[model samples]
Target: MPDAIWQKSSYSAANNECVEVRADAEAVELRESDAPGLVLKADPSVFADLLRTIKAGELDHHA
Candidate 1:
């Protein structure tokens, strides 16, 4: 994902320490702004499920 176009959440803090995401035909990439070298890749559908889980507060108990 070295050439991927990364984007951050618009609601991210002004300090710019936030998560960034990039997507390609095969997978979606995620990385931290403060640690770009560390990347996580996942299937698009899996990423969508993660997003839904987060929005639905399914992981709230863990927090």
Candidate 2:
């Protein structure tokens, strides 16, 4: 098991939404809040770039 501190997504609503995140020294882990046993790990740098791209409207699907 990874030593991760789990957190729900800010975008998640009060009705038991689906996303969560875990922060570690070098990366962020994403998972389903209801399923704490599963995780998807990502590098911090790549995650940062992904966030930046989302903020910059580079993700057309979100717009």
Candidate 3:
């Protein structure tokens, strides 16, 4: 992921703490602003499914 251009989520405020993402022809990468050295990579379809699941709130645990 060298020289990868990361984009921060719009939901984040004007702060350094945020979730960043980068996508290339091979896969999509995700990382936290606070921890740039750590990254998570996933296939395009898998990442899309993850986004869809999140939007659907399938991972929500609030009572």
Candidate 4:
């Protein structure tokens, strides 16, 4: 995590209604912008797959 650079989502606005992400060599870190103290980590590959599923609308819950 030494060289991880945290970035907020592109859709996030000045009101801060999104999470921040940091990617290191091994894993990706995620934390709410309004609550930086709470962090979540996941494998980079798994994270990428989740993002793809989201973009493809494969995990939508509502019609």
- The candidate scoring highest on TM-score is 1
What does candidate 2 score on TM?
Answer: 0.74
Screening candidate 3 with a backbone cut-off below 3 angstroms (N, C-alpha, C), the clashing residue pairs are none
Q: After superposition, how far is residue 59 of candidate 1 from its true place, in Å?
A: 0.7
Worst 10 residues of 3 by lDDT: 54-63
Residue 40 lDDT in model 3?
94
Runs of candidate 2 exceeding 4 Å displacement? 61-63
Question: What's the C-alpha lDDT at position 6 in model 3?
Answer: 95
1-63 in candidate 2: lDDT tens per residue?
Answer: 266567787788888867988776688888887787777888988888998998888898865
Q: Tens digit of lDDT per residue, candidate 1, span 1-63?
A: 568789998778999999999998789999899998999999999999999999999999998
Model 4 regions lying over 4 Å from their true place: none
Query: Which candidate, 3 or 4, would have the higher TM-score against the true structure?
Result: 3
Best-first order by TM-score? 1, 3, 4, 2
Residue 60's C-alpha lDDT in candidate 4? 90
TM per prediction:
0.88, 0.74, 0.84, 0.83
lDDT of 2: 0.80
Model-by-model lDDT, in order? 0.92, 0.80, 0.90, 0.89
